[model samples]
Every structure is written in C-alpha cells, then in structure tokens.
Target: MIIAVVDGMGGGIGSQIVSSLRDELPSYVEIYALGTNSIATSAMMKSHANKGATGENAICVSSKKANVIIGPMSIVIPNSMMGEVTCRMSEAISDSEALKILLPLIPEDFELVGLENKPLILLIKDAVKLMKKEFNIK
Candidate 1:
C-alpha cells in the first residue's frame, strides 16, 4: 500500500509519522510523504518513507496517488490556519480515492521533555493500529 503523510513547515509531525510507521509496519507497505515545505519532506524521508516530496504540487500529486492519507484533521479544511494548507491540497486529498486517518489532538502539549511534541507518539500508535485494521497489515 502507498500511504501519504502531509505536513507543513518544520515537518516535525510528518517525520515522526513516517519513522514510526517504517519501524513498526511490515515491509509490504510504502510511505510516500508530501511536505508543504522542504524541511517537512526531508524530515519524513529521514524517517524512512520510500519517497517524499515538498511544496504545493507535491501535496496534490501525493494525495491522489496514495492509498491512504494521514494527518491532522485540520488539513481537510482549506483556508485553515492562515493557509498553511491550501485549498488545492485539501481538495486533492478529500476528493481523492484515499482513505484518511485524522487525529484531532492539539499540536500543543504534544512534547516529550523539551522535544517537539510527544502527544504525536500516541497518535502515531493509534494511527498504526488503525492502519493495521484498515489495511489488514497483519
């Protein structure tokens, strides 16, 4: 399966998701990440996605191609957060054939002792579990 992880700016969230899934998921699945910025894509690539891309166009392409899309629930809403995520990105994702696994947890309070954010750990775990069920990974 091809999974897409979309994120903005720093990519802290997307990176964590890619890494955790790569480490825990079976080899059959491929993660394709699209970051709104280069940093986000690179972070996720370092985590072990089969491939990654950055910027607006990448987001649109990945959303359409991925078997599944994973990210914060906010991403579905275009014109949200002052356009950190564009309407094109949101539409490509929402209108595409991919299933989405969204988490509503606030990005704040998501840290692990001076780290970026730890709440995402739980989110990732939950996401993986959901993926397992959704894709029958195991």
Candidate 2:
C-alpha cells in the first residue's frame, strides 16, 4: 500500500513518522514523503522514505495516489504550517479518497479538545498502530 506522510516547517514530524513506519511496517509497504518545502522533503528522505516530493503540486498529485494519508491535522488547515500549506494543497489532501490518519497537532490559534496532549513519539506510535489495525496488517 502507498502511505503518504505529509509535513512542513523542518519536516521533523514527517521524518519521525517515516522512520517509525520503516521500522514497523513490512518492507513492501510504500512510504511516500510529501513535504511542503525542499528542506522538509530532504529531512524525510534522510529518514528513508521510499520516495519524496515537495510543494503544492507534488502534494496535490501524490495525495490522490496514496492509499492512506498520515500527517499533522494542520495539513488540512489552509494557511497552516506557517502559511506553507496553501488552500489548494489542503483542499487536495482533504478531497483525496485516501484514509486520513491525522495527528492532533495544530497551530496555536486552534484547539482540539479532549485530547491527552501526548508527546510526538507516542502520537506517532499510536498512528502506526492505528494504520496496522485499519489495514489488518499482520
């Protein structure tokens, strides 16, 4: 399956997600790193994504091809990621048929109530676990 990991603003989150997926999922699963910028894409590539792409066009195109889209909830929020995420990019991701596994992280202006505010590592682990469960992997 093709799993798209989207991120921006340093790609730290995307990199971690790629690394964890690489370690947990079977090698056959394709992990595509979709970044909002070159720096973010580079970071995820360093973490060993099967492929990487940058910018709105790349994201818009890749999202449609993915079986699952995983990223911070900000990915679907227009003008999030310090404005790196455009309205068109957000729309494309949101409109994609892929199942979305969004981390609750968001910009300061917004709030996701009732979440435990777990650390990033735990959040990523939970995401991977959910992916496995949803797809019935292993």
Candidate 3:
C-alpha cells in the first residue's frame, strides 16, 4: 500500500513519526515522504521512506491513488506555525479521499513538543499502531 508521510519545517515531528512507522511497518509497505522542504524529506528519507518530495504538489498530489496518509493531526490545522502547512495544503489532503492517521497531540502551544521527544513519539507510536490494527493493516 502507498502511504504518504507528510511533514513541514524539516519534519521534526515528521521524522519521529517516521521512526515509529519504521519500527512498526515492514519494508514491503510503500512509504512516501511529503515534506514542505527538502530537509523534512531528507529526515524522513533517513527513516527509510521509499520516495521523498517537497512543495505544494506534496498536498495537491492524488491520495485516491494511495492507500493512506499519515501525519500529525495538526497537518489539518490551517496556518499553523509548527509548519508552513498552509490552508491549500490541508485542503489538498482533505480532498485526497484516503484514510488518514492523525495524531491529536497539539503540543501545548501548537508548536513542536519541545525536548520531550520520547513521550511525543510514544504517543504517536501507540495511536498510529492502534489505528493501523483497527484498520487491519497487519
């Protein structure tokens, strides 16, 4: 299945998301890194995404053609500071018609969850894993 791992601003949380996914998903699964910048994509690339790209097309791209889209719940939040996740980007994903696994952890001030990386990753890890199980992706 094709899964787009979307992120922005160098994918600080995005990379953490990829780390968790790396632990859970086997290699056969298709993983795409959709970042707002090249750095974000590179971070996920280190996590072993099959492909990576940066820009508006990351959002405008088709989702109906993919199996699922995974990222922070904030990705849907328009004009958020954590990333340059513009309204148009959010709209593109919303229109994709693909199943999404979004983490509800809003990081106190709508920013990255500071130095508390472990807990943040754990929260995302558990949530995504449960969602994947519910969807029977295993």
Candidate 4:
C-alpha cells in the first residue's frame, strides 16, 4: 500500500510521521512524502520515506495514487499551510479515493474541538496505530 504524507512549511510533522511509519510498518507499505516545497520534501526523505515529491502539482497527482493519505487537518483546507497549499492541492487530496487520516492540529483561525491538546508525539503515535489498524498490519 502507498501512504501519501502531505505537509508544508518546515515539514517537521511529515518527517515525524515518516519516521514512525518506517519504524512500525512493514517495508511493503510505501511512504510517499508529498511536500508543498523542496524543504518539506527533503525533511520527510531524511526520515526514510520510500519516495517523495514537491510542489502543488506533485501533491495533487501523487495523492490520487495513494491508498491512504496522512497529514495535518490543514491539508484539506484550501489556502492553508501558510498559503503554500493551494486550492487545487486541497481539492485533489480531499477528492482522492484514499482513506485520509488527518491529525487534529490547530490551524490558523480555527480550533479543532472534541480533541484533547495532546503532545505531538502522542498524536503521531495514535495516527500510526490507526493506519496499522486500517491495513490490519498486525
């Protein structure tokens, strides 16, 4: 299965997700790091992603081929990621025929209710667990 990890900015979150997935998941499950920029893609690649790409078009096209997509809640919101995420990118990711597993991260001007303010590590761990369950990894 291909898991597309979309992230922007410094890509700290995407790197963490890639690291955790590489450590916990079988090698057969490929991780595609789709970044809004080169810096973001490099960060995720350093974390051992199977493959990676950058820019809006890359994200939009790659997302469509993924079996699953993991990233911050901001990914689905148009013009998010400090405006690095464009409308096409958001729409492509949200419209992809993939199971999306978004972290309840706090975005600008919006608070994700019904979610505890957990540590970043804990949130990432939970996301990994959800992905594992979805694929029956165990």
Top model by TM-score, which number?
Answer: 2
lDDT of 2 by residue, 1-138 (tens): 999999999999999999999999999999999999999999999999999999999999999999999999999999999999999999999999999999999999998888998999999999999999999997
Each candidate structure's count of clashing pairs: 4, 0, 0, 0
lDDT of 3 at 8: 78
Q: Distance from true position, residue 108, model 1, in Å?
A: 9.6
Task: TM-score for candidate 2, please give it.
Answer: 0.98
Candidate lDDT (C-alpha), each = 0.80, 0.97, 0.75, 0.93
TM-score of 1: 0.85
Residue 58 deviation, candidate 2, in Å?
Answer: 0.4
lDDT of 2 at 61: 98
Model 1 C-alpha lDDT per residue in residues 1-138, reported as the tens digit of each score:
899998776778888888878887888788987887787788888888898888778888878888899987667777654567888888888998988987663344343354244476897888878988988877
* TM-score, one value per model: 0.85, 0.98, 0.80, 0.97
What is the per-residue lDDT of model 4 for residues 9-98, given as tens digits with 9 covering 90 to 100? 999999999999999999989999999999999999999999999999999899889999999999999888789989999999999999
**Which runs in model 3 stand beyond 4 Å of their true positions?**
107-118
Backbone clash total, candidate 3: 0
Estimate, for each residue in 1-138, the C-alpha lDDT of model 3 and write its tens digit.
788888877687778877777778777878888887788889989988888888777656745555778887767777764557888888888878788777665545666544354567677777668757866877
What's the residue-level lDDT of 87 in candidate 2? 100
How many pairs of residues collide in model 2? 0
Error of 1 at 118 (Å): 9.6
